[model samples]
Target: MTGKSLSERIGDLGRRLAVEAHTAWLAARDPRVAWFARLLAVAVAAYALSPIDLIPDFIPVLGWIDDLVILPLGLLAVRRLIAAPLWSELHALAETASERPSSRAGMILILLIWAALLAIVYWAVRTSPLH
Candidate 1:
């Protein structure tokens, strides 16, 4: 059999990578994906922050290899599980998440809700007490 040209091989690789990325993006939307995602996210975080490296950053051209390669590869692996159609749905979910509240405002709203709930509980407890 004849060998494939470089361009054809590259195209095939690109298609495979794209499919993997889309699959990963789809998987990210499912609650079932949480366990594996969390584990991968944790590992990625550790790799980013860890002192160890395949090519230490002090070595100039080689130093950033981990940053350029490992992180992207890990992310791609995660993306491979994501489904393509769910991407739009996830975008909508992301927009809703962002529009709801900034973190500070969300925290304040949660505190206020908890205070109101506590007040109701207190009233119920006091009003119903035989003591």
Candidate 2:
């Protein structure tokens, strides 16, 4: 059995993931990294920062599509596309910035929720027997 407690293990995992994601962001700007790998990295970084989700989070079960499925997949792809040495170099220099690097999430979530409610209301009114 691994000696570390669950919380410690989780924290370690979180730090490692953070380091990998940060590496992708930094690697995107590095000329040494191949252009296509850089492009993929840039897309992953932009997606992680972008609040305009492909699937709205208000939906049941599927709301977390971007977070649970898309981002992880993108990260995995980035990890795959980048070379082992580059990843190793970047991982060693890891700095998981504490602050969120974007400003759009809260506003976007509010807007999406409002839009969903409005659509529901409109649908109800259009289908009502009282009409």
Candidate 3:
């Protein structure tokens, strides 16, 4: 292994992930990317930025697994779908961009989704025979 400490490596990985997510965000907005790839890119970027997860972080092992595995895999798939030259261009742009973008719209969408799910659960419980 390299001489760098574990914390240094972790820091580097975090930075790389940040750049990759930013690149995916850029690809999502670019018309040059295929429709399917753009859709996937948007999903990956939203999930990366959103506070909610498919699995709650309180769950043992599995919750952290999604963050560690699913995200990087999704980013990798987006990278593969994009042409090499285009991907490189986007990566460079992402690294150089002054401001890392935040998605208020994505946050709102996530909140709406959670609200709907909560409402459904409440309705179900209220209507249940055991209630």
Candidate 4:
């Protein structure tokens, strides 16, 4: 282990961590993985919003180590709770999101509806000074 190649090791770790987090997120988005995904999302949010850190942020080189290490570990742990069918559905959803839509009309309809809701919300908020 001469020279110790710190950069290479860190890069590899980063890649793995990203894949794990993404896989968990995708799995959670699927209806089959809904329950587990919601739970995982909650836990991740809690950890992110909590002021406390597993590894305190005072250390120089490893201040945010918990963010890197703990998140990936939690993602992997959530991944274990996912089922095969849900994973398959999630992969299908990913593929669908990448493909161009077949119906421009449908997309336009959805956009119009969203825009209308946004307009209504904007009007309501603007009229209400408390908001």
lDDT of each: 0.62, 0.80, 0.94, 0.67
| Per-residue lDDT over 4-39 for candidate 4, one digit per residue giving the tens place of the 0 to 100 score | 488988887765554444455566555655585668
- Candidate with best TM-score: 3
TM-score against truth, every candidate: 0.37, 0.58, 0.69, 0.47
Once superposed on the true structure, which residue ranges of model 2 sit more than 4 Å away at CA? Answer: 1-17, 96-131
Per-residue lDDT of candidate 2, residues 9-110 (tens digit): 868866666666777888898888889999999988787767778888798778776667788788889878888898777656656353436568888999
Q: Which residue runs of candidate 4 sit more than 4 Å off their true CA positions? A: 1-4, 45-58, 84-131
Q: Rank the candidates by lDDT, best first.
A: 3, 2, 4, 1
Error of 2 at 97 (Å): 4.6
Model 3 clashing residue pairs (backbone): none
lDDT value, residue 20 of candidate 3 = 95
- Candidate 2 whole-model C-alpha lDDT, 0 to 1: 0.80
Candidates sorted by TM-score, best first: 3, 2, 4, 1
- TM for candidate 3 is 0.69
Q: Write the per-residue lDDT of candidate 1 for residues 27-99, one digit (tens) a residue.
A: 4446755677746645654564568888888999789766678866886555454454554465455445435
Measured by lDDT, the strongest candidate is: 3
Better structure of 2 and 4 per TM-score: 2
